[model samples]
Target chain A: MRDSCSRELTCIARSDPRIIILSGDIGNHMFDGFKAEFPDRFYNCGVAEANMISVAAGLALSGYRPFVYTFAAFDLTRCYEQVRIDVCFQNLPVVIIGLGGGLTYAPLGPTHYICEDISILRCLPNMTIVCPADQAEVMASLRSSLDHHGPMYIRINKKNEPCIYTGEPDFSLGRAQLIQDGNDVCIITTGVLLSEVIRAARILEERNISACVVHFHTIKPVDEIMLREVFSRFSVVVSVEEHTLPGGLGGMIAEWMIDNRIKSSDLIRIGTGDYFLTHCLSQKEARDHFGISADLIAGKIADGLNK
Target chain B: MALAAKISGNKYRSFVLMSDGECNEGTVWEAVLLAPVQKLGNLIFIVDNNGWQATGRCDDIMHLNPLADKFKTFGWNSFEVDGHNFEELLNIFHSIPVDSEKPTAIIAHTVKGKGVSFMEGDNNWHYRIPTADDVTRAKAELGLE
Candidate 1:
């Protein structure tokens, strides 16, 4: 994701000289290409998230679109006040790329866990949140965020996940993609978990229960119109995410359902329960333990319909 | 001021910042120094330090003790005045021959949330958007009727 961001930035800078890249001592192996391509435009702020964010705001005021990249926790929460006042209050076009989304740094321990990044960032006004499902989605998201106005937070995973899309798909800011169509259930997924939703759909197919998969890359400014269209067809909706339930994809979907006065649908949210992860575990193992895996999702749907 | 700017070409320019503690980053500090060095005599630096920094007390971070003394050392004409007194602020503003002289610094001592009950002199009020009820009581107390 970091490499992809760097490449996208390089392309943007070639056309727009005002594009600046600011890093907080991270992205060494990633941003070398950007530095080589545009030395004057890239800056290494050196482990100071606060200074980096403020500098980006200042650069924006000077008529430059700055992209600040760092770890998810520091990039969003550490300099939150700076982001709120310096960037968002001024409504600058600063793309904050947060690497290591959710529990991607599992073995690295709780200090690196960014479960609350989405919730904390959601409270800020005029800040768009983008969670790309895979490399393909992230590439499209990077382009979309750069083109969009105002502040944006793009949360990406550290490790390289499989490419979700074979052919290049057109990406819009607030649109949700329907990966699969089902009459019985619609499974909404965000981030890398969308890959799991595909697996879950296949598992449910064997049980004769069709589960539709909707990949919601953009969380804020949600596509209520698209959701209403999908909700019209399916009776039971299951939302999946790698982060905590509250303020994640599930909570957003549920809120949209309530706000639009659309009721009588059994909404099942599959995500990390309100507890900190104990030990280092792979993404698959963590999801299974938390009952957010494909088979578990299939089982939960069967039980919900039976009851 | 224009003569000094002409000598340096177009590397930098200066603007008078009517600012408070809300903006205290290095760029702002750099801006403060640039005015005098660039001979931007029209530059006026006002620090409305209501004795508040976000999180906790300002002194805990680093004692900006004798804040006025720092500006004097920076070769700017400095003044300390009571911020709430409209006449005093106006008098100080009138006193500065800013058109000909060097840059000026006005350190105004005042409360954080001025002229309000429950919020005045509080650091927490810096970021807290007043609730509707609080706004009502405040307007009423200030005789907004």
Candidate 2:
């Protein structure tokens, strides 16, 4: 995630010299390549997340698009007030890339968990929330974010996930990409969990359960028009995500369904269910434990259609 | 009225006592605080001792105990200066030899609404902006007439 962020920022810095990078005592070593490429554009703001956000706001006011990166928890929650008042509230165009969304840092304990960032960030006006699926999606999202105005929150995973698209797919702002086609079920996925959803769709396909996969990378101002189109195809819609069921992709999809009066036969949400996981585990293991794996998702779809 | 008179009369310095209502209400307190910091460089901030907010009071909303200590923490060289002493107020402000680096705070110990015939140490005035009659009475009491 940091690699992609640094790369995008470096590319943007080459063209737009006003681009600056601020890290909260981390990412300096990882961003060495960026520093080497654009020496004047990088600044490690130490452990001061609040000060970094404030400084980024100042830099943005002075016509610099400051990219602030840090661990998801400290980056989003620790300096939430600063992001809210200083950046989003004031409509500053600063890119805040929060690394390790969901339980990406599973073994690192609860402090590292980023389950709440989506909800908190989405609630802010003029703040664009993005959770790209994979490398291609990352680049596309980064490009879009750079070209975008106002504050943006890009939640990224820690490890390299599966490649969602072959190359740079056509990504539009607030538009969902329909990766597969099916009539029985429509699987809406966010973040890197799109990989799991795609895998689940293939598994469901073998069992004669036609499932469509819609990549909802952009959370806020979600592709409601695309959703209505997707919903018309499938009777049973299941929203899959790495985040908790509440205030995540599932909740957003549910809200959209409710608002549009699209009453699917069954709405199965695959995610963490009201409990933070304890005991060290990998991302896959954590998803499995929370009943959000490919097999579980496939089973839920089949069962929902069957019922 | 006292504040207006002091400002209009060309007084070199003045003080503003406030409650938490002024602080949390928005930039009114910030503007008030910055006015002194930006202005006289000699103004003193005295937050009245009777802790009160709106529904309950200061201790109810949030106990800011060692109140004087909190002001000191606000980049202001502050201590508990006296409340009712004309001589103490004069002496305290006179004795504060200015160090331009830090602003000075004198948390004067005073009742919330002191020297009032009816209302004294009351939280009602926190949000109640003075009316025409209230302004006239306040002006009369402060010798503005």
- What DockQ, between 0 and 1, does each candidate earn? 0.02, 0.01
How do the residues A1-307 of candidate 2 rate in per-residue lDDT, one tens digit apiece?
5577667667767887878888765553577788898877777664457778998999999999888888888888878899999999999999898888887978776777767788888789999998888877777787887688899988888667888788778887788888988877888888888888888999998998878788888998798888878777666778888888788888888887788787754578888767766677887788888878888888877887773
Error of 2 at A94 (Å): 1.0
TM-score of chain B of each: 0.80, 0.54
lDDT of 1 by residue, B1-145 (tens): 4445656654332435443433334455566677678666666677776766644445443346577887778777788999889999999888877454477788888777777778887766755678899999889877895
Worst 10 residues of 1 chain A by lDDT: A23-32
Candidate of highest lDDT: 1
lDDT of 1: 0.77
Pairs of residues at least 3 apart in sequence or in different chains that clash in candidate 1: none
Of candidate 2 chain B, the 10-residue stretch with the lowest lDDT total is: B20-29
